[model samples]
Target: MTASTANDQRFREFKMPDVGEGLTEAEILKWYVQPGDTVTDGQVVCEVETAKAAVELPIPYDGVVHELNFGEGVTVDVGTVIISVDTDPGAGPVAPAAAPAAEAPAAPAAPEEDEEPQGRQAVLVGYGAAPSSTKRRPRRQQPGVPAQPAALQAELNGHAAPAAAPAPAAPVAAPAPAPASVASAPAAGRPLAKPPVRKLAKDLGIDLATVAPTGPEGIITREDVYAAAAPAPAPAVAVPAAVAPAPVPAVVSADRERRVPVKGVRKATAQAMVASAFTAPHVTEFITVDVTRTMKLVQELKQDPDMAGLRVNPLLLVAKAFLIAIRRHPDVNAAWDEANQEIVYKDYINLGIAAATPRGLIVPNIKDAGTKTLPQLATELAELVSTAREGKTSPAAMSGGTVTITNVGVFGVDTGTPILVCRRVLLRHPW
Candidate 1:
């Protein structure tokens, strides 16, 4: 044998190490490496899906994956072992089993409280760490503190989340807004200030709607909210509730094997849904949202001339609400930062809407949606659904979706925890 080939030890390989940011499992969103691809340690080798967003995962060691336990879109619980790297076992001492660095994450921000669709927070290693043991943790309750609503907690984290104000939201359409809308405040079109600015407005009781938008395209961003609300304004008196939520209905269907047509969008929806549901571990929690203002706003938008002839449904409000909430709660717009073995928060929103098309159930995101108005959202939803129905939607439109709303109501069903689609959605716009 030649001297180079004599050292067969150079072909030594390794299994996928648990990224160890408390990740118990992960969904293979996309592979950055394969059996044939050579990669160095700490290189962004793949994108993994967690409960909240798609995260780029890095190879912890230098090598190639000789084997993978599951294919793309498969959920892998932490420590279960995946991907054997084929490289020199003596590769300068592969540091397996070393915990993630503490300095890597001091905790990224969380999503809007509502953006948490299905609950589990820490399913994949490097997203939210799983509980140490399967045995349930004892419930510790303190006196005088009202019990947190189940909706306030992440199903994955198994811990109650903090409370959040309800903000109206809707889906955006098209590629990201022009760069002008991503940065500073402008009298015309700018991204406006960041989410922090909006929170300041909320705390000070400033109405974003009334602020003369100085942002790009005259959009009001978080910074404008702050500038408008710097002086604590008086709270607007909340209108009395004129309606209440209907009772929850039983999910058990009386008819089994009912002939639901297998035509068009249903087929596509079925395939994607099945892939997402069975492959990813799901933990969903529901909340009976009381969006009285949302209903009121719909009424107001109807009378406004500028919003004439637009589709304004409760779903639109939900989208808008998500955006508003994200301004104050951006954690929802994030994903597992697996390469860093941590959760990475995003500042933007790629709003997703689930459409039941003649081709199947499809979800297309409205990119850079964090800055649109209600009228714009309504128009986007209209176009999104129309595109899905015609099967004219591009793959790009179907990808990069952040959070999603199934709109089960269209099918005469209430909200349901949707299964992960090739895993799950993205960003800090969680709800």
Candidate 2:
């Protein structure tokens, strides 16, 4: 349903733009607009989570949305057309065929058919559809038929298939008597177990009729299947004179280990670390200073009316000290531009504070930290920590950092070699 150049000249395809530094793709996390929805220039149509951060993409031109090319959770490549917007507002009702049939549902007839096209039937994506409850139709089991193929049975059993044997002359053995605790299964009725419990019972080779149900309304549960599969304890009269051995832990073997695709923040962090490690010549320098007075100052500031309701910690003083050092030696606050063969001396300090969140190590900087007072800096630091923790730190917060200060002390490390964050001078502090 994506707008093709051959389809209509008025239908402009909006390509997925790179929202971060050299990010090649992003996962469409959520869509805010749908087909036939009226959108204006600069209106946010969708939110995409890239390798670096989550960004809301805005449509550049005012138009009626035609179709979205990809579904949510789809990692679309940069420069790929994700959505098509029809510039003509007077265009007729978007044909159900215009959108993917799987996504757009048929509209019910009503007096206001004109209104239905705009509000109901025109949604061209599954994400926009209202939730519908579904029930599974009962599968009838056939007699004298194996549930699985013979090849699959051999593979699951971990053995080669044997040659077919002659039919038994008589009944081999009588069926085991139904236990008093076990309930009898209803005639021609499916087992009263949930899908997961049924799967567990199948894997354990336990029959539902052999398991006594403890769950409400005679429904078989996972615990019931496990109890039925478990070996019964020996009676005192049946036991040998020797002591009973302890139960051994079962060993589990898997055919294959689960593999999670490396993408998003984790992937970006890996690439950045590798590039920085190879390209930047890292120099490690350690300095031990007496922070006895600094600790006392932080305590004093906490009680001060100026620092009321602000996070007054040793990190605040440490950040301020780094800023003063940068001011003392202004030349170090510069970057070597390899492409231009020039040193770019920056006048302002965009201090980067390294934060470890659930996503990855993100260095969101305080813009113009040098211009802020102690209270202002503390406030900014508190906000930055909160934003990073919520995974809502913007790309702008991570960009334009001239110097980075990583407090490894928070991680209980005394000292560590911090990787250069994209050519910036890194300062690591271990408590």
Candidate 3:
């Protein structure tokens, strides 16, 4: 190979690293940089979806992009080179025959064929070193259709490319005022925006027609919708005039067989539930009690100056009651270790509270909750609920729970068979 070709071979290839713990593979959802685009180190090149969550992969070298090994929607194994970058962009391509074979040993090879130099170990930090072997799944296509490029195939398959790189939301723009002649006129055309953006605008009570478009090709953007909702002066002044009220949309009947993909937190919850149901021999008991005095105390707590601005709801009392009950019957918090043929008793109470979020149900617990005073428990409980609702609960927050509490009364649910979290005792409260 010629010296120029040898220089080009110095291009760095970035592999699909393991983004999550024990993740074996990920589906390329979208590509932010196509071949020939200039890329910088630490720039997010693409987004991938694993079993647990969606994560973005960043390029690690500064260079001109050479090629993308696979197209969008392709499920790539960990350690497979996904993109190549030519470090020397100014160098021109040389004829392969013109180069001396002995001098051009590093000329080039397809990413799949490329191997690490002997004696030098290359590691991608948190991802470890690329695997010695790599494999790509065969492309799926119509019987007669010819093979297409990665991007084109991705479009045809409709595999999460659009959501890969969510367009940066623009400020919500208000709908521009209409001319006097068309003040009461129906919209001349449909507003331009992605379905998600439109849904957000609808939820925020922002009229699309009134929102100004700042996106490319006069598209309405999320930022535009948010800007309209802002108290600041809007770029477009929406005309407030009497117009026919929009007709209510009829609700469609539910499908008999509604299929929901089990993944992420939902999948984890399902697996845990199944394991707990079969592995643990549960003996449940129920007691009805008058909570009239409890409700009076909640009211009294709200009136107390010290409790002002803090959450003092029925759940708080329920949590405290469980803690007191556990304190009296410490043996209930023990776990049965079948493998060891022993019952493991706990010294501390890491009380977990079940919370429902938009994504799925999660149980984030308060650490050493049994040691905390009532006020401290209330504070921790409030924070845990808030974090769970926002989907920001960390794995650490959800681990090491000695027991769990699920408040069915919050949903007007009288009671529920609370599943154990990791073979631990779980309590259900109705009031």
Clashes of each: 64, 0, 20
Tens digit of lDDT per residue, candidate 2, span 1-431? 44443346677889999887776899898999988799999999999888777778899988888889999989999999999998876755443334445766678555442233334455565446432332224455444433565566666555577666655555445455544344554444565899999999999999887777888767888889999999899765755647868779775555456677877777888999998889889999887888899989988998999999999988899889889888999888888687887888899999988889887888889999889899899999999999989888888887889888888877677788888886665554635
lDDT of 1 at 55: 53
Residue-wise C-alpha lDDT for candidate 3, range 1-431, written one tens digit per residue: 66555855767889988776666777787899999999998999998766444567789898889989999978889999999998778867633545445664685544444555455566666465554453335665544444465566567555534434545655655556544342233346777789999999999999999988888767889999999988876588665566756779877668445777666667777887899889887767788889899999999999888787888988888888888888898998887787898889998889988888876788778988888877888889989988777655655676678888887776776766777776675555554
Ranking by TM-score: 2, 3, 1
Q: Give the TM-score of each candidate.
A: 0.36, 0.57, 0.49
Best by TM-score: 2
Q: What is the lDDT of residue 315 in candidate 3?
A: 83
Question: Best lDDT goes to which candidate?
Answer: 2
The TM-score of predicted model 2 comes to 0.57
Q: For model 2, where is the 10-residue window of minimal lDDT?
A: 129-138
Ranked candidates, highest lDDT first:
2, 3, 1
1 versus 3: better lDDT goes to: 3
Worst 10 residues of 1 by lDDT: 422-431
Model 3 worst lDDT run, 10 consecutive residues: 178-187
